[model samples]
Target chain A: MKLISVKLSPLNSKKNKLKFSVTVTLKKDVLDPQGKVVQNTLKNLGMHDLKNIRQGKFFEIEINEKDEKLAQEKVNEMCKKLLVNLIIEDYKINILK
Target chain B: MRSSVIVFPGSNCDRDIAVALQKMQFKNKMVWHKETALPKSDLIIIPGGFSYGDYLRSGAIAGKSLIIEEVVKAAKFGSLVLGICNGFQILTETGLLKGTLLRNKNLKFINKDVHIKVINNTTKFTSKYKLNQILKLNIAHNEGNFFTDNDHLKELNNDNLIAFKYSDEKGNTSNLSNPNGALDNIAGIFNDKKNILGMMPHPERMVDNLISNKDGVNLFSSLLG
Candidate 1:
């Protein structure tokens, strides 16, 4: 038996819950035209304190299992299949027991 | 009602949509891309295919076609238009639909059976179903991700233009199960007046219970009504 805990972020609140905090960020080479526009807006808004604001998604997931290794595998599979878009996004996993 | 499926040079799924419409008893016409005008019809379908080999961007190259001009006119004249897969991409390219179809989050060709939640059943394309109902359909594409601005999304939602949303097998419309990471898991949508509809899923491929599920047949049937 194993147990797993996952947390998703509120960055993309459209389909995600407001509470879970999982961080999914865009890859380095991917173009972020939207982020650039928002950055320009911030500068105009006098929030001159902001810099290099790249955009990405954050997610938090909770797993109920008995085997730690198996649970990790499941979570990783989910990330590969659905969560983290490997082509343009890179993801990091944080697990809690 | 007679129907026509506009066939671009690189469109692969044109035949499937044609077949589906044929099964529904609509006289289907295969209109070529160069045709200046669409044959008379109550509905026009821009089936999915890699127009112009997805050259510059998914639908960027196909947006300049002369046929698109007529299609736009037909839609404006109140003809029903349905775009599927690459057809959806083309709709965005032509500005008939809102938002853009970006590369898949994973950047791989994904093919699988996915669940879709009917969001707006008031449109002719989806009026056969109830809201929040789940239907299993097949999805195959590499550039199906949908993107839109926050203000535009809010306006779309408030205007009741959002048609269908992606969901899980249990019929949950959560962002977590968005296979292509679409905004609001929006599998399909209608125009402001509800005549034009575009979706990334292949409803044409789901017409037969022997080969695939028949969940999508109702969409065409509703159009007939």
Candidate 2:
């Protein structure tokens, strides 16, 4: 499974609109069969060291807010509102200017 | 009695459930998902089928639709809510019901008839059946594996909110009887007030005798009364 790789740059300016990146992943306890299938496939292909794989989604959300703290707050709300279901998933938020 | 079935885009089973309601003598309306308000009705049903093509997790997209706002309001004010198949997924996603449906442990879409025991007949949905009665119902879905944290499971058990449990022909529950690897053989559940029901089985498909049997007629009849 291709996990969403995000490289965060430190917030350097106050006027620039920040690009809020959010990663949603299933909770550790939830079973991820698709990831397991990919793991098994990789193991069959001779990557024997593969122990496991867990699949999840990622989103790069654009926010209009200029203040770093306010932008982070908005992204946090977005994650709680729709980007994730806390029942079986966890989310991480990253803000980059 | 009056009833309404919410019709979301890509929902294929709304008509089936509408037919079931009509046959049971309920004045039923097909409410589109875009509507901001529901027609005054005694019951609102979320029927089976792939809403929003099951994207971004099954029922996740539809759960956020504006129509769900009305659904949540109706459910809270004592209007009965019934969710079948994908509807069950939506109910869970909406937090109107608890738990999540993980992909089947066997990693395959299951479609077949199975026996479910009525666990809580006191609820509005299962009142017609005696407790522990085995009823043959059809379930068809890829993600029907019912999962909840241990604390939630304990609370559900303590509250007697588990509406249905997978069982054999003789009403015996065991690991072998669970088709979807659901926790505690749970096939259906009710919210705290017992006004909401979420189950993977297609009771609408079983409401007609010509189709095979009217095994699901009692469920509708119970609600109609």
Candidate 3:
């Protein structure tokens, strides 16, 4: 079993809470046109000295699982299922711990 | 029935919608953005294109146009309004619709012919189709991803405001539903009153059988008939 690093945050506070925070990104092979546009704009504005402008998704997830390992597993499952488009996106986990 | 297509300076699809209305034998008029009043019409259309060059946000600046005030009044009177693509963005900006169009998840200006399933056919724009039937139409846009708070999304669903959902031939949905890559695969929607229709696909672009699929003509015929 992979040792999970977890970043815990309160996503929604109700009778029961949901803790969620994840960052999903495009696969390296996929293009980032919006990032390129911003890069060009910056270049035109005389910032000609930057590199690797890629855009990615920032997702704040809210799920219910008390066990840290179970929470990590569930979050990973979500990334594979809906949070990231496997065909075009790549994901990395940032657990608070 | 009296109809008018509102034209802002950069709206390229105004004429396309007018032509569709013309084929339907509607007395369609072109109402310019500078005008303070719309001609007496029960149906109003705000067609697609980069209105106001899509500055600030996709349709933010254009929402404040002088002509839209008249539209707000008309909508209050129970008149019908249909907004397509950029027109949909403008409707969201003007608060006639709830939610905003975010940049495509892929962040690209995607253009493609996609399939849309009629989710709610009880509205004026979609009454021609059966529920869950798939229709083909073209989608062209960058700022077509729809976003709203969970409460609002729930309200839309509970109120039957969702008019269409984009899907594939197999009817599977996900991030993949957006052939043009819009959010939640939402292709169209109606206001709470069911009098306003806002869709991303260009029904006008598909009116002629030889040029494109004639699926769109049914919508007009249903409204007029």
Best candidate per lDDT, number? Answer: 2
For residues B72-130, write the lDDT of model 3, one tens digit per residue.
88998999999999999989888888776767766678888988888898877778888
Task: Predict model 3's lDDT versus the native.
Answer: 0.80
Clashing pairs in 2: none
Output the lDDT of residue B205, model 1: 88
lDDT of each: 0.80, 0.89, 0.80
Best by TM-score: 2
Better of 1 and 2 by lDDT: 2
lDDT of 1: 0.80
TM-score of predicted model 2?
0.92
Candidate 3 segments whose C-alpha is farther than 4 A from its true place:
A1-97
Candidate 3 residue-wise lDDT, A24-93, digit = tens: 6655644556777888888888886887677776767666555666777888997764455444457777
Give the alpha carbon lDDT tens digit for every residue of A1-97 in model 1.
Answer: 1222223323333233212234677677565645767798999999998887787766676665545566667777866755554545677766643
- Output the better candidate (2/3) by TM-score: 2
For each candidate in turn, give its C-alpha RMSD to the true structure in angstroms: 20.1, 6.5, 15.1
| Superposed model 1: Cα runs more than 4 Å off | A1-97
Model 1 chain B: ten consecutive residues of lowest lDDT: B55-64
Find the 10 residues in a row with the least total lDDT in model 3 chain A.
Answer: A1-10
Q: How many residue pairs clash in each candidate?
A: 22, 0, 7
Docking class of 2: acceptable
